[model samples]
Target chain A: MTAGYVDEMHEAFQTDLVYRSEDVPLECSPKPKDLEQTLHGLMKLNGLVIRSLEEIAGRGANAVTYRAGKKFGHEVAQYFQKRDDVEGALHELSDLLRGQYSFEVWKPEDKDSYIIEENGETFIYLVFHDCIVRQTLRRNGLDQGGPLCQTLFGYVVGAIEEITGRKAKLEIVHTGPNACLKKLVLK
Target chain B: MEIHVDKDACVGCGLCVKDCPMHVYELQNNVSVAVRPNNCMGCLSCHEICPAQALEHRGIYAAKRHYIDIHVCEMLKKVI
Candidate 1:
């Protein structure tokens, strides 16, 4: 990564830590999928929603689309949180979603490493390879950085909040065509 | 992971080299080659950027295949 880009990302993360501090309520019902057919149907619906939003709003509507996507993710996380602790919920959710999307989700091995505390802030890392969002964007002739793809980012932030019961902010550190590394910091 | 560069179709545009975050592809003899197979994250960014449809990868984590339009993928398979 270029130095300027790294600096920009650092600044964004710092700003998120300072500005986003309101926690969202966790009162949602969790829905777990028991069948592959159900998973496929859900993914299809999600793809449709994102595509329709992109078509209607064009590139300029990424923020709105991403916010919508994150809301969906938060709901999904709530469902998992009902059955497990924060770490367990995150792991189980990642496993279930990766199966639906056919992607690899790599998390830190050491449990303590999963939560980072520095300068009075806490964060978690979620790294994905072969993301379906990236694939879908490419199919639609869109770049990885496009607004349609922000849905996944929103999803991550929402889900993390549901699991941790704390407001969090997502910072995308690296986004390539097939991979993305993000940090979700508690606000 | 193994990346196959179709010599016949490659126009050597160097897009793969420019787009890959891991520096996995490099220009060799005017063609793009996957010099760092282990570093390949299977993101398939290079595959998407290839104008000539010259790239194929195997043994990488294949994300949900449904993202590609079924008809378009089938036609590309036949052509490539």
Candidate 2:
């Protein structure tokens, strides 16, 4: 199942890249295993830094960590743009990372929120179950919706902006240690 | 994968039954029971939501566990 998913993603990414620009050179990207390992390390480091800062800075750390996460997300979006358009790249990136990280099993909560397109705008809704961020926060006896969770929020925002070529809005409607609902609006 | 629900600790709140995306839990006689154990993806949403912490899962992907700094934990232990 995972292999098939990976192959489909790779094919989609390649197809999008070709469709975007004929002059863009095609090259082999890093193996999925390598990317997964690197992402694991990065997530660990990010969690550590965020946790330490939260301990020292208390509630004030939320903004600082959120900004840092936003920066990281922007960089990731830019990197994905090298191969495909913003939206396609972001979708591929989200799927690839989710499969690799094993953080949570995301499900579409509502049909309407699944994918809605109207008036040259798009809205996507995703529900994360058993997220690693929430698990870490619970283990540490911290509240949900803290900076750790905001990192993912910022990431989606940054990626959406890159894809839509417009600043998108993101909101977390509900959150708990085991589940979170996030909405992304593209205009 | 095995999921065990403690009957004694259960408050029958039905949170687990309502929250499980896969319908692994079902409320029977006002008590939550794991009816479709195979459907469980080991997301542990039930485990986290259970007010009495009545659920225990075994032989499932627990995901990577992150721990606090050992030195800090040790210091805190002394202070406590």
| Candidate with best DockQ | 1
The alpha-carbon deviation from the true structure for residue B25 of candidate 2, after best TM-score superposition, in angstroms, is 7.1
DockQ scores for all the models shown? 0.25, 0.10
Candidate 2 residue pairs in clash (backbone atoms < 3 Å)? none
Give lDDT tens digits, candidate 2, residues A1-187.
6999999988885743334455564654676544655555655676677778889999888777667767776776665554334446456546635732333323332333345675787766555654667655655566678788777677666665654466666667566443465667755
Give the distance in Å from residue B68's predicted Cα in candidate 2 to where it truly belongs.
8.5
Worst 10 residues of 1 chain A by lDDT: A102-111
lDDT of 1 by residue, B1-80 (tens): 78899988888889999987667889988898888876666667687778999999998654444454555668999999
TM-score of each: 0.56, 0.51
For all predictions, the C-alpha RMSD in Å is: 17.8, 14.4
Per-candidate clash tally: 5, 0
RMSD of 2: 14.4
TM-score of 1: 0.56
DockQ for candidate 1, please give it.
0.25
Q: After superposition, how far is residue B52 of candidate 2 from its true place, in Å?
A: 5.3
Docking quality category of candidate 2 according to DockQ thresholds: incorrect
Clashing pairs in 1: A30-A79, A70-A154, A70-A155, A74-A158, A178-B43
